[model samples]
Target chain A: MLGFVSGIDRDLLRQFERVSQQMERMMGLRGANGIRSGGVNAFPAVNLGASPEQVDVYVFVAGMDAEKLDISLQQNLLSISGERKAALPEDAQVYRNERFNGAFRRVVTLPEDIDPDQVNASYRDGVLHITVKRKEEAKPRQIQVN
Target chain B: MSENKHIEAQDQENSAMQARGEPESVMLPPVDIYEDANGFTLLADLPGVTRERLNIQVDGNDLTIEGEAAIDMPENMDALYADVASTRYQRRFTLSSELATDDIRAEMKDGVLTLRMPKRAELQPRKIEVSAG
Candidate 1:
């Protein structure tokens, strides 16, 4: 024991050091695709905009593979499901892990009526871009009066 | 006061024996530092921090990354299963003077934290035109 170490001070420092080290191993934050989670939607960073041509949806999901992606459309609701595989190596011993794994689902309400059949989704560089074509009936038709 | 100090010294000797080594590892989130035309982009791994829990403070050129990571372990489980009780991370980095601290922006996705520090207008490359008489 160092001369400066006191029982109370030693315990306090031990806890502080433990906490500080724990802070170092947080691999990443846990998040859901779109649904409300713990009072807050995982990202809540989706951009909401509707134009005449198509509806563009950008969902941020880094470190995820395309094979694990699942997108479904129910009426005006769009649900996305996938998983982010842990980045750790299989053979390595894990001292600590902070990233959430398993399953995730997010449901987004479409701003405009969309043709589910014509929707297209692509995942590239960690972002899931979904293009939902607007239904013909939902598009504005210019009407001329005499 | 002298008596208390003597007792405390003895107590410290015991504590020292209990805690004598460094933590296994001092790992941090994956960070990518890039310099672009606009400014610098810092991408860090911040697994358990939510937007509300994230705190960013830039005073002068000192950049601080402070955030709380809440663990998701259930309380009622008596049986043991594989687990990693790791949560919480904090780190700090110094910023360049050319960066616009006021215009810095951060966004988190999945477990990655992206920080964009835009360069000040004065630091931007501007083409100068010469008048021909």
Candidate 2:
């Protein structure tokens, strides 16, 4: 039943993908143990925004220390990686374990080239805020309208 | 590098607002609860929430955890892409009488809240020594 597609292939494929993803999220089965190998809607949802001066990326990751976080930028792709160690006491009996702990990665492709030196990252109240200034040449230049 | 990126571009043209009569959505933050010989340890993920904004209360065997995240967006900036949704965190747990609710210790750091609630003296495991015959 998964071999051939004859009519309305694109629509069917889109529907199927949406349904499957929703099911995975509902079942808490998404993400590769907190490692995102370049897939959309991966672990640790993020917000990306770009201003005239810089590009900003905010990732929601709690229970991680500075030593556990590793960030690097190569070309236009910015990578974020970190690990959240499990917080369980010794000889403890677990009642509920809904939160996920371990390694996680998130990558975003910027629209314009950013100066690697101008990148700034800060961790506050459990959120990691990253800002990369836009390159001077990449910013829009407006000529006097004649 | 052909990995899938989940970032979605935020639409800037359409400025829609929630209805005034509608109630704000409350998100149930994920948590882990573990019980040990002395007490229980609870860890909850509450990103973007400050210590002042987070509140934990226990009353009549009911434990409630709530936090509000204040994400201040700069006026000069515009959202180009977004995947994470902003939400207020809330969760409630019914505690057993065997647990001591008065001396619960709570701490928030790195966006995680850890709560240590000790069990009553009678609830904790204890070994009794037998007299030699």
Candidate 3:
């Protein structure tokens, strides 16, 4: 047998909502086709930091190719450009399409003084990693306090 | 006024139906991309797509997901709000060689499609010890 609760129950409802959303994410991954709307943009999540000597920029760009990517730095802005291509099997019928594929370009700005010439770029798995060494004048320094 | 509005709406709906080809399949849902310490997480919200009809491919730097979203009913069945949409999906990402090609992993749970790409060890930072006098 099951019992019913009154609509006045707030805390219990909140808990139920949280659990339901978590369960939805878990269940969603199993059969997710793609997004619904079209106007959404993909911004690669990044982790960047800088110290006295270097600046690091990391971008999450999976399902992409390194060769197809173009990276450049002008002033404080870093630019990234690439394209996504899709292929279909002969007998397959398309009913729903949610994934984004086509031309993608993203620009990021750096915070510290870096040697653009000394910057290093690499890609592992699907993530793109870039590191730039800061110029001597831009590095933080401490003056002796007497 | 209501009559004119209704007629305009009807004409618009009819044209929409005609353009979309009788709505044989539902449209695909939107997906979100999240990146973290490990790598990238791709989530796709596919509602009625069956595993049998799903097709995933990664060639060179391109990745594509295609499948049909079939709405099958058992005997006497009815449907309501939130219709499912099915269409072909083809996406690609150009990868860099610095990434270890052997470590990409993918999994599907519920109706979400997740693809994980771990960061390579060489790409991660390493500490260097300084010699002291």
lDDT of each: 0.63, 0.79, 0.57
Interface DockQ per candidate? 0.03, 0.52, 0.03
- Candidate 3 has a TM-score of 0.38
TM-score ranking of the models = 2, 1, 3
Q: Give the per-residue lDDT digits (tens) of candidate 1, residues B53-110.
A: 7778898999888666543322432211111233445677888888999999999765
Q: How large is the C-alpha RMSD of every model relative to the true structure? A: 19.6, 12.5, 27.8
Q: What is the interface RMSD of candidate 1, in Å?
A: 15.2
Best by lDDT: 2
Deviation in Å, model 2, residue B122 alpha carbon: 3.1
- Tell me the lDDT of model 2 at B97: 88
Predicted model with the maximum TM-score: 2
Q: Give the winner by TM-score: 1 or 3.
A: 1
- Residue by residue across A1-146, what tens digits does model 2's lDDT show? 34445456867988999998787666455333223333344667677788777888888887778767898998778889887787566578999987877788878777557888799888888788888998998887998988
- lDDT tens digits, residues A28-110, model 1? 23422333321222431233345665676666555566778899998888888876654544453343444445577777777
**Alpha carbon deviation, residue B14, candidate 1 (Å):** 17
Is 1 or 3 the stronger prediction by lDDT?
1
Alpha-carbon shift of residue A102 in model 1 (angstroms): 19
Can you tell me the CAPRI class of model 3?
Answer: incorrect
